[model samples]
Target: MFQHLLVPTDGSALSDAAVRTAVTLATAFKARITGLHVMPELHVFTHRIDTLEDTQERYAQLAERHAEQYLAAVARAAQEAAVVCEVISVTHDQPDEAIIRAS
Candidate 1:
C-alpha cells in the first residue's frame, strides 16, 4: 500500500534489522525505498584552538562518510531483493526534526 517508504537508520544492529524489514515490505508492495540518516549536531564544545567551523566541518564529513557506508549496505540489500532504493543524508541538531524535514 506504500508508494514510497522512508526508512531511518542509525547504523546499529537493531536498525539494520529494521532496514531489512522495510526492504521486505517494499519488495512485497513494489514500492520505492528511501533510506535516511540524520547527523546529530555536536554539542561538546572544547577550546582546543580549533575553530568551531573546523569542528563542525569535521563532524559533517564523518557523518557523511558513515551515512554513505550505511546506506550503501542497505541499497545493496534492496538490490539483491530487486527493489528500488534511494539514499539521503541530513544534518540537524535534533533527530526528529531532521527526519520530519526530510520526509
Candidate 2:
C-alpha cells in the first residue's frame, strides 16, 4: 500500500534492477515514484591548484549531463510501467547522505 516511492540510481546496470523493481511495485500499488540521481559536490576538490584540468562551468555541465542520462532510464521504465514518476538530481558529498535526504 505504498503511496510514494523513492528510487535512487547511479546509472549502473546493477541499479537498473532496483529501478525495475521499484517501478513494478509502484505500478502494483498505484503509487507515484520519485527517481533521484545524486551528483558529487564538484567544488570540494576543484579548488586544488593541481586539479585545474577544466573550468568549473565545464565540470558542472558534464556532471549535469551524466546525471540526466542516469535518471532518464528510470523515468522511461516508470513510464512503461504506467506509474507516475518525478526525477530530481542534486549534488552532495556523500551518496548515502544524499539518499537519506531524498528518502
Off by over 4 Å in 1: 48-53
Clashes of each: 0, 0
TM-score of 2: 0.87
Candidate 2, number of clashes:
0
Error of 1 at 23 (Å): 0.8
Report the lDDT tens digits of candidate 2 across residue range 1-103.
8999999999998889999999999988999999999898765455576556566668889999988998999999999988999999999989999999988
Question: Candidate 1's residue-wise lDDT over 1-103, tens digit each?
Answer: 7888888888999989988999999989999898998888787567775687788788788988999998988898889999999998887778898888888
